[model samples]
Target: MPAPRVSVRTRIFELEMVLAGAQPPVRRRVQVPGEIDLAVLHEVVQSAMGWTNSHLHEFEIAGRRYGIPDPDWPSQDVVDETKGKLFRLVEQGDRFGYVYDFGDNWTHEITVEKITGAEPGVRYPRCVSGEGACPPEDVGGIWGYEEFQAVMADPAHPDHDERLEWARGSFDPHRFDLDETDRALQWLAWRPLAPVS
Candidate 1:
């Protein structure tokens, strides 16, 4: 007998990150290995949400905060996200919170929708579907996003031209390409580096 053929289990989560009052929330349906730690989940979230991974982030569940604790700054109130496993913290239908960029307070509400077995040949962590584009990083959170949208929509706004120019390559607040997201996931999962001599 071939070691009883163990099967890999996966968890599917429906993550929604919304700027309160902002029209059309950003949502992602993601699947990950059940045993993966929260740190990996953080990466999954970043990949799924079109985030640049340039800011600090934290996960809050059951009243505890999880993130990469700065050893130099011990006062930071967070446990290592690497130490917490998703299966240990939540089950199907559980909801938690994630906050990225503490200064801007970009918060996301995460819900565990289903627990299922991994499909053969499919990537462990990938975004199956999503809606809306993520807000630009360093845009001062929800309020700033809303204001930025307003300004961008009205070319006559005082700072419209400057903001548009600044946001040149990433000003599309309405675009969400599944292929782009899947490509990002593939790249993040397996990127080639220079081979060792």
Candidate 2:
């Protein structure tokens, strides 16, 4: 199939993805091309949220499960994520769940805030706005993350030095770099686009 272009008729999905149960709310507002595949959308979410994509992930929308097939589970009911297109499955104001890392169970709530025509001279799947640093991978689930933060905050704690080393130096729970996140998604600009003439 030919790559879809962003034109007058081709809309964009403005999505807000929030890390479920995050204390300060790690969230991102992004614009994704209407025709992209869900598999690529997974990449977008990973980039915008600063996840390393080091673990398994899946999407649950409207009672349907979608993910890559696991060879270990032949009867797995997941529909191939690559076979699903973003625009085909969602409309404005729709909400869905995305869980990354089965163990940590980092649950994210994704909502389609609006659908609008694409703008000229702009990239698709751009991170427009966001806040809060993504929790370190393998830090455990919400409860583990909470404890990790506490440990990192108290230098006197016995585990502080070890945790800091694991985090690779000073860890700022509130640090989130918008430009950095946008830079990570810059490769998505390669998506074919042709303005309506």
Per TM-score, the best of the predicted structures is 2
Clash count per candidate: 0, 0
lDDT (Cα, tens digit) per residue for candidate 2, span 1-197: 54455676678899999999986679999999878888998999999999998998999989999999887896988989999899999999999999999999999999999999878767787899998999999998888999999999999999999999999998787888888999999876644355446
Q: What is the C-alpha lDDT profile of model 1 across 1-197, one tens digit per residue?
A: 22112144344444444434445677777766666789878888888887888999999999999999999988878899999998899888888998888898888888888887655555656677877888888988889898988898898999999888879834667778988887777643521222335
Model 1 CA deviation exceeding 4 Å by range: 1-21, 72-75, 188-197
Worst 10 residues of 1 by lDDT: 1-10
TM-score each candidate: 0.85, 0.93
Q: Which ten residues in a row have the lowest lDDT in candidate 2?
A: 188-197
Output the lDDT of residue 49, model 1: 86
